[model samples]
Target: MSDLIFYTNPMSRGRVARWMLEEVGAPYETVVLDYGTTMKGPDYLAINPMGKVPAIVHNGRAVTEGAAIVAYLAEAFPEAGLAPTAAERANYYRWMFFAAGPLEAVTADKALGVAPTADQQRMVGYGSLDHVVDALEGAVKANPYIAGDRFTAADVFVGSHIAWGMQFGTLPQRDAFDAYVARIMGREAAARAREIDDALMPQPVS
Candidate 1:
């Protein structure tokens, strides 16, 4: 039996974990959960009290949150080269937390039409949605990946956000962002993970 057990609903942020797992090349058993009853059921809740998808149990330890899971797997499978060295780890952690924090918060606020005013923006973590977006654009423009030239687990988390943002108009478009996403999408592991999740998506009634 594989040491890692992944509990996820393919339609959710579990997609990010799935992509990270594929990149790690670790053998894992997937326990798929349904949206309503299944995800809220006792068994899964025992695993994640928040009733969230994309939680993974590795060596009897449960890990939730997409960015954390991605980072965990990178360190667990050091051979994958998805984790950055000590010198570069700060940047890696910087963008990962940036994605999970300010960027996520601002984008969510924007989507819900609860945008912060100029004064509120200054007091907020992201400063403003535009500032967050511009910062990300400048980072990726400077290097092919979030941590630097080398691809790391940070990209899996941040790049996914960037990809979805660009696709859904949640983020502004830029040539550097476009090329960066194209490169991330080009990975065979990413392709496989997406194909698997696409198949998992619910189909129309016959």
Candidate 2:
């Protein structure tokens, strides 16, 4: 067994982690778990009490959450050049967390039809979905990549959100978003990740 073990369900946000793994070009074993069964079983629970997919155990240390996994792998395998340099650190961490926190929350709330009122908006981190969307738009429009000139692990996290958001209709189809997605998704690593996950997705019965 490799020192790195990846636990994921292809249909889940695990794809984000999978993409990062591909970018890192590391040899890791994949463990696919089914919902309500192996995913929630005590064995897996020990690894992640949240019973979530896309958890990684590298050198015997466990890391969970898609964004964290992306960041972790970048640092763990620095030769991949995915980790941000000193100059790119600010934008890298900023937009990465923005997508993980506000962008993810607002989109989920929107999908579930759970809109916050004006008074409640102040308490919510996202404030409003439009605000989050506009912020993301500006972030992508400001640079070729999220961190600046080069693609960082931040792109893996933020780009996954943008790509998935556009695909599922959670985010609007703006020209800037369209162009950004096209640019990042065109990466060879991104294509490899999609092919792997797409093959793993459940197929319909004949």
Candidate 3:
């Protein structure tokens, strides 16, 4: 039996996990949850009580949250070489958590019609919108990728966030983001993931 089972809605954050699955070259079956239907179904809800997408089952265990899923897949498929080395552990965990924490906060705040004032933004952990962007800029500038010259599973998580932000206009498309995304999107695994998910988007109502 395949060791992985992935539940997702193509239109949601599932796309990010799909990218990570591809990065690790992990073999898995994808059960596409129907909107307003499968996600709320008892069978699906049991897998993720929050009714969220991008949840995975590996080795008979379930994992949720985009960052957690990415991290899990990296370790689960170590042969793929998608995780950071011992020396890069700090950066690996740092950027992965940042993507899930601060980035999520900014995206949620923007979505909830709660734009922060300059002062309020300063008091926030992310500091300011520009600060977040600048930090990302410097991280990529210092290394060929987020965790250094190597591409790790952290990139799959963090880079996916950058790619989505740039595409949706939520995050500014600066040169660093542009170059970093270009490098990530060029990966063979990422390309395969995009092709599969893109082709399966929004299946017809039956």
Candidate 4:
């Protein structure tokens, strides 16, 4: 068996984890899942009952969810130096969860054309789009990256979302976001992942 096994669909958030795998320079086996067919297979469900993409089996343990997977990989392979010092732990954890929660919520809202009323804003953890965007702006603006100058896995989590948003025209084309993506995408690992996935997309179906 391979040292690592990754379950994913190119069209899903799994792309984020795929980028991270490349970041760590880890050799992994991939099982590409179709929309609804093979992902839910009994064997795959044993790894992730939710049938989610981006789930991984590493060294006999299962890790699921994009954020968790990124964190796990960073910790699992410390040689990559993708995590931060203990002093940076708070921001490290905060941004990862924030991306999965607030970032996802606000981006989804923008995509659906739904604006929250003032009262409704309080009910949501993100509060408002302006609040969420401003928070992201402050973090990246202060440092070249989210978790300070180091290109930690946290950037992979939040950066990928911002990159996707920009690519699809769902996010603003601010210079900060543009520069942030350019920095991350310029990494050799990120480029390798994109190349591999792009090649996979053009292969003939069996």
lDDT of 3 at 188: 90
lDDT of 1 by residue, 1-206 (tens): 56999988877889999999999998999888988888999988998999989899999899999988999999999999999998779889999999999888888787788877888877788998878988998888878888988889999999999998887778888998999999898898899999989998889999
lDDT-sorted candidate list, best first: 2, 1, 4, 3
CA deviation > 4 Å runs, candidate 1: none
Give the TM-score comparing model 3 with the true structure, all chains together: 0.92
Residue pairs clashing in model 3 are 82-153
Q: Please list the residue runs of candidate 3 whose C-alpha ends up more than 4 Å from where it truly belongs after superposition.
A: 122-124, 203-206
Q: Highest TM-score, which number?
A: 2
The candidate that wins on lDDT is 2
* lDDT-best of 2 and 3: 2
The estimated TM-scores of all candidates read 0.96, 0.98, 0.92, 0.93
User: Considering TM-score, where higher is better, how would the candidates rank from best to worst?
Assistant: 2, 1, 4, 3
Off by over 4 Å in 4: 202-206
How do the residues 8-97 of candidate 3 rate in per-residue lDDT, one tens digit apiece? 987999988998988777679999998789898899889899987989999889999999999988888889888779888889999889
Candidate 2 residue runs with Cα over 4 Å from true position: none
Candidate 1: global Cα-lDDT? 0.90
TM-score of predicted model 4? 0.93
**lDDT (Cα, tens digit) per residue for candidate 2, span 27-136:** 99999999979999999999999999989999998999988899999999999999999999999999999999999999999889999999999999999989999999
